[model samples]
Target: MSALILTSVLGVVLLYLGLSGNKSILAPTAIVGLVAAGVMSWTGWNPGLMEFPTMLKFDQMSTLFNCAMIAVTVLLFLFGIDYYRRMEENVAEHYALMVFSLTGALILTSYTNLLMLFLGIEILSIPLYILAGGKKRSYRSSEASFKYFLLGSFATAFFLMGIALIYGVTASFDLAVIGQKVQAAPNNVLFLLGAFFVSIALSFKVGAVPFHFWSPDVYEGAPTLVTAFMATVVKTAAFAGFYRFLQMTAMPPALSDTLLVITILTLFLGNVVAMRQSQFKRLMAYSSIAHTGFLLMAVLANSAMSWSTLFYYTFTYALATVGLFIVLTLAKRAANGNEAIVIFRGLFRANPWLALVTMLLLLSLAGIPLTAGFVAKYQVFMLAIGAGFIKTAVFAVFMALVGIYYYVLVIREAFTPAEETPVLVVSPINWLVVSACGVAVVAFALWPVLVG
Candidate 1:
């Protein structure tokens, strides 16, 4: 796709531009490039690479995902303008690495071959390992980078082994051929084992439970921007790949049972554990895991509306998450880098508009009515019920209700009084992102056409 080529090229351009020692131009340049990439994706002008039918095809889902990833990245780079202003070096590297990671993500959404999937996952991940450690001076950042690298490496091994096993069975790595083989031998133990192993690797990528231990530590330790990128764009791509892999190829009954267990455990652990977290980022981390359970449910439903439901859920969740992280950044600064939820104390008094926007974003995340999050969850529940997963759907509802308490805790803190409330200073760009996210959620919900 032209957008894919453009993003890959843009990352390199940023690197070369970084050499000129004029750091001021990086974010704007990157944002402009991202916008152009997004335009190319949306317009359906995927020139070049048409001959490689077995490799990639930018169909509706992939194109939609590509555009969505590009759009969120534009938002991140916009925030990067302020986030990196105080940094001395490597600002361009940050922008460039994110673009490169995005390049891999685009590939993941479109890849038709297992080899391409492996390539895409590596391309998407290698940059993140570095970005997590971008804050070189922080020990926690170094720890995050190292921990993520080690665990991710292990996951990759499992993924590759699974691919090999599947190849061994089918004598091909092409998804279409593999699909045919899977149906030909539905009860083939080796194929199911391969699928199960692959599922574990993907679950690790998306932060699903049992494979989710790394998310909170990583989210809390990595630079918030990188964490936001992981939580949003990386997630969107991973789930899309996951749904495409399982659904398009036809999920085996054995694999469905395994996912059923995973979804329940992910729901139980993610919500129950989040209540114990006092740190803001850690809470968001577990909140993201809880969301993983919901997204897993969407994937499991495997209905005609599954992908649409997944995209809507992830995209809206991304908006809320990005805005909340910006809010957290501003609050953290005001509190002299304290990451506790207490940093938000008196936010309503210190900056009423920012605080109000914070409340709205939290509400959306908590699945409150009239917000996009609520609609997203409702759609998932309906889809699940329609698919005859009523027991699982009901359990999910209870967990969702459990999840709301933590979000409300943050919202309450924002609205509460403090003797020494940190004086948050929101930059206009940050404020705009926060307010826009808040409005977009409500706007998306009130409009019946979009919701329907």
Candidate 2:
């Protein structure tokens, strides 16, 4: 908990530095702090309590997520180095805000109390509100900021209310206490209702369907780097929280059924909608939502290796997304910042390596065999089938097939030849960013111990 607090405070200080116009220092400073904090988190990671009075855990799961979040942010910071250098004005604040948001993410991953969960969500989200609109002068950016703030606050309210109700029934905010109370009276309606409300709050945070209205617009409007932060780090933390919430016995069979339905709806909505998207960012946003559904399926299936599955899924997904977003930023720069799929047309002719890397990412996302995605999806399917939800698993398989089409479309465009030479210029750092992700994706696919 102290580590979480220190990192967040460091982030806040950095944000202050950023807004004060120290643009060049923002990324480097943040990178160093995150790396140090990440190391501390890893070294201290074990089954133990920190700030026991406040109720937070620093277990293997938390450590893994902390490491993953740190790594993702490091890459984003590196990408931002080149991506934001062009837009010099808000550079400082942008990096600072990202760090602050990451602080919130760390808390969300390790939180053990309902109060801490609420605090973590607020900390994580409020900075994002500003980050989303960091463009300062763009109407769409401002609009995205306002929309996300309003909806995110509404979700937070639900979360707080649920926490209150759960505290009322369980007479404590600690998850441990709540678990005891829940098992003691498994049929308690108020506890169940609180759990349901809490589920709603978490669902919104992760951008699951029916609560995913903010995603496409936000992804389309917000700066690309901000979108990547929300997509990878924010989603991962929320799922970690969501998984923790469902671990209690109070998550009744009826609630489980409801979650299963949500899983299916999210999958269907995310995939079917993404198929029609022309914008690459929007396609990825919807693709993320669909992936949430797949992740939730693993959550509902509830196996011993659920944590491992989640770790692999989110880690690989984040890696692929960070790489893809970097490529998108470069491609958009080449096309005068156009995000359309057509921007990638004949990309291979202009830069075969960039195009190939992009194709590999899309293929990984599609769960093509021999990629990390294949293993991730396969694990979920096995979990569902093992849990005896054959029908749900089968439907998920069908949706997986449906998802393949859109990813293939992206890949097809990447390989398509352009009439003009593509002027794709990548900095050494961004090139390293792309190469690192590519390597990690395949490296994990073959070794799998990268996760272990």
Candidate 3:
């Protein structure tokens, strides 16, 4: 626990350092700090506190999420190297904000109390609000920040009310104690309302349908790299907290049924809406929401393997999104920084390696076989079926097929030839980001994940 806290503090310190205009050291320092955190977590060294009065557990689950968060942060730092190269202004603040967000993410994964949970969410979100508006001169960026802040604050209020209600009933904010009360008598009306509110709060955080209104706008408005960070690292951390909440208190029968209905709706809506998107960034945002629905199904699986499934799915999904976003940034730069789907036309002819990398990433997102996305989706289906939710799993599989179609269209554009070819050159940093994601996705699919 001390080690984890140290890591979180160090990230905060790095952010302060970044604010001092030291662009050259920002990414490297963050990478090194994340690497250290990963190493400490891997060694299995930490205080065994039922942290925050038993609301959070610093056990295997928290450790797994910590490691994943650190890994993602490391990759983001690498991508940030080139992403921020030309932005001479606010360089320090940008890097610092990232570190602060990462610290919140770490806290989120280890939260033990409802108060801690809410704190973690705020810590994670406030920095992102600023990061979205990092481009001070861009109207779209400012719009994105404003939209995100308003929606995020609304969600946070809902979460706070839920926490208050839960505390009112149980006279405790500790998750374990709350779970005990729920299990003792599962039909309490106020408890059920609290649970529903909590679910809605987290669902919004992960961008589930009906509650996902801000994602596309924010993703489209923010810088490509910032969008990637929110989609991947911030999301994984949010889900970690959501997962803990579910595991601590199994939903009552009524709430469980409601979640089942909501999950199905989210999956359908996410896929259906993504099909009509023309902007690559917005498409990815909608697609990410769809992916979130798939993950929610895994969480609903309620099996021994749920944790491992969530961890692996998040890693692979993040791998694809992180890589795809990196490609989008570079491709956008090549096309005078446009975000249109057509910007990728003739990509294969212009740069085969980059195009192929993009193809693999899209393929993974679409859950095509031989890629991590396929394996991740397969695990989700198996978990759902194993839990006797065959109908829900079947519908999810159908949606998965639909998902493949849109992603393939993106690949088709990448392979299409342009009437007049233009030269494309990519930074080594972007190339490294693409290559790392490609390798990690394939590697995880081939190996048995450590989480079991």
- Greater TM-score among 2 and 3 belongs to 2
Model 2, poorest ten-residue lDDT window?
45-54
Task: Give the clash total for candidate 3.
Answer: 6
lDDT of each: 0.91, 0.86, 0.84
Evaluate model 1: give its TM-score.
0.98
In the range 1-452, model 1's lDDT, one tens digit per residue, is: 88988999999999999999999899989999999999999997756644477988888888888888898888888888899988989998999999999999999999899999889999999999999999999999999999999999999999999999888888998998899888888888888888888899999999999999889999988999999999999999999888888864588788999999999999999999999999999999999999999999999999878988998898889989999999999999998899999889999989999888888889899899999999999999999999899999999999999999999999999989989877777789988888888898889777666656
TM-score, cand. 3 vs. native: 0.95
Determine which window of 10 residues in candidate 3 has minimal summed lDDT. Answer: 48-57
TM-score of every model versus the real structure: 0.98, 0.96, 0.95
Candidate topping lDDT = 1
Instruction: Please provide, for model 3 over 1-452, each residue's C-alpha lDDT reduced to its tens digit, 9 standing for 90 to 100.
Output: 55466666776677677667678887787778778778877675655642443645567877888788778877877988888888887776777677778778877888778888888899899999999998889999999999999999999889988888888888988887888898897888888888888988998999987899999999999988889889998889888888888876685777678778878988998898899989999999989999998999988876667888888899889988999988887778778978899888989998899899889989889998888998999999999999889999999999999988889889999999988554676778778878989988778777765544
Q: Quote the positional error of residue 348 for candidate 2 in Å.
A: 0.9
Mark the regions of model 2 whose C-alpha exceeds 4 Å error after superposition.
Answer: 19-21, 45-50, 449-452
What range of 10 consecutive residues in model 1 has the weakest lDDT sum?
44-53
Clashes in candidate 1: how many? Answer: 0
Off by over 4 Å in 1: 48-51, 449-452
Per-prediction tally of clashes? 0, 4, 6
Residue 222: error of model 1 in Å?
0.4
